[model samples]
Target: MTYFNKNMPSGVFKWRGANKWLLMLLLISSNQLIAKDINLATAINLMLKENPSLKIFELRKRSLDGAQYTAGLNPEIEMGLEAENFLGSNPYTAFDQSELTVSVSSVIELGGKKDARKNFASTKYGLLDAQRKINSLDLISELTDSFIDALATQERIKLAEESVRLSEDIYESVKRKAKAGAISDVEVKRSFASLKQAQLTLKGEQSKLERQSVNLSLYWSEKQPQFSHLSGELFDFGVVKEIGQLHQNLEKSILIQALTMNQRLAESTLAVVQAESKADVNWSLGVRRIEESNDAALTAGFSIPLFKRKRNKGDLMEVEAEIDSSRAEQQIALLELYGQVNEFYSLRQAAIEKFNVLENEIIPALTHALELTKEAYLDGRYGYLEYSAARADLIQSKKSLIDTAQSILNYGVQLERITAEPIYNDTAQTQGGDS
Candidate 1:
């Protein structure tokens, strides 16, 4: 990057300390009264609390809790009563000749069916938890993307303002030179045109910032944005890991965990279906009364499911196929994850290199060139066209720096989203070990 120059406007340099806060406040317009600045941490907290998509997972967990309860309950008992032979014939029709029976019955599950069902339900909970994490990561990734866009826009607004400022200065100088007859009137017209274009660009960027801010706030359901600005070092991406290092942590992604959980849930379902294949028995014990003998006797009986039934055979095959499908899906997901990691890793490395060259070489050179061009124009050694070209080159270089920095941050976010781990490894952000 160019060395901080004593003669350059303060806006060209990075804002620091109190000047940063002053810049933030000055950026606010008269129309915004209660607006404040927000950081990434605050945006994340608001998104987690107010995001609508996560609420469904909470409701689904409640529904599964009910399913687990239903799965654990035993078969319900039935009560039955029967009377016969009271009204049909002389010997068997009257109440004294009638036989009466009362019974209680229920199905007795076999093959540990209840336990298998309970395990099946319990296994779903683990799967649900994993899916929830995946959804959360997805939402967080989106929020971060919007936050970065808004922050980048904020930085662009500053650059646009700087451009307008320099354009106004050039326009004023050219007008004075035209009045003194040192410069042609055509130069004044050209300078004025450039100044107008710069003003328009500044306005356009400001409008873009408002839209970006609204997008960031909408994640938290705010129709009207509360924060006038998202404050951060958008240029500072910190130390990033190499593509190979990022690949090693591919298993850490929530997507991989979710796939493993799916396979497990499928396997657990197979167990439940296997348990179901073993038929259960229905049984009853009762008291029978013989009116002719005026005596009571106990009776007991049981019936089993058709011994040769094969209805569950189809279900077992289906569950086994599901397990196979889940395994295949895991393989596919790993490949996709690897591909995504590689894409962002390569892109981010290139972006970082681009940013360094712009910051250290190109911008500094253009800044010095623009200063020299302005001096030459004033001394009649160079034309206004040369001065204008230098100013445009410097402005474009600064814009490139901002855009490159934004690209670097976006690539890092994508890598982080893919790995479900921090892609940025700046020492300052790392947590200290427990004492």
Candidate 2:
């Protein structure tokens, strides 16, 4: 006997089929049951751990550290065995007249060459460290921007979903009025068209959200995002710093520090080159054996180059030129950073003003107008066109608000990148609540 039944409700099967998509929509609509709830600080820490480019830079720094250990050491000692007066005479053929010498030779650095080389290597290592800091800052800024974009896309998706629901409600109302002879069939058809457009907009926003998710995940080298949604507020406005404060912190920026390190590296290199101009002495010590006399003696000698100035003039001049170049580059970098800070600061101020007007005034006014239009349409005092126009205006205004908020975040990230400091600290919530 089999216990099987096929007489289940069609509604149950329909819901079962639709449940997967519904779950996905719910996940996108809210931050619930997420696999990972990453905020700005968490994301940055993850990138620092998993980002491939950052890891490469760290490895390079370690390699430079290893090179520093050998910088101050003398050259390897050369060992040799020499035999003279062998096979030249009958007595030498059997080793009676043979002479053999065993020797070791090494170049002794002069003019503090060892110390200068060590200093140069130390400076180079410091420059690498500075470069790694700059790279990390750049990566963090980029990740912040991408994370904000993903969050904004999520908000847009919610708005699109709202638009779809609104359109559906309006369509149902138009259908009811048409059946009661209060509105024409043409009006019902127009309402249905608006509903379809809203659905299309929702689909488009969902697609955009997926792309933004992929972009954010790319920061940590993940090809696919593990989390279904980002959990952060997009409209977290904070007090903007003054231009003078940003300028004052400019010296502390990783880029400026890197440039300063470069200048020091150039100076250290010049010192090494100047030290190289003094010739190093090569000295040898050995034991010689004279088989004919059957006696052993010790020998020592030293030699130094006579034309040190002519030999090293080119190298010294090249390093001098490099020092001049590094100085000019450092100055240029400072000026460029200042210009960037000012530009982002001005833009941030503008974005804040725009966001305030849209969030505080325009959006609320439009929402009220939309409500009034909806009531008028329900009473048959307004046409489908007017209702749609009002709804469209309100939706556009809301999107504009999101855009302005995104701009604020973008400018904030740029400011952070320039100053190597947070413009808006993420405290797990938006400041003053979500716009």
* Superposed Cα deviation of residue 304, candidate 1 (Å): 1.1
Which window of 10 residues has the lowest lDDT sum in candidate 2? 426-435
The global C-alpha lDDT for each of the candidates, from Candidate 1 onward, is 0.85, 0.84
Give the C-alpha lDDT of model 2: 0.84
Considering summed lDDT, which 10 consecutive residues are worst modelled in model 1?
Answer: 426-435
**Candidate 2 C-alpha lDDT tens digits along 365-420:** 99999899999998889898999898899999999989888888888889988898
Q: Give the TM-score of candidate 1.
A: 0.86
Model 2, TM vs. native = 0.85
Candidate 1: lDDT of 285? 92
Clashing pairs in 1: 1-359, 1-360, 86-93, 87-93
User: Model 1, stretches more than 4 Å misplaced?
Assistant: 1-35, 86-97, 291-293, 307-309, 426-435
lDDT of 1 by residue, 333-373 (tens): 99999998888877887887788888889999999999989
Residue 424, candidate 1: how far off, in angstroms? 2.9
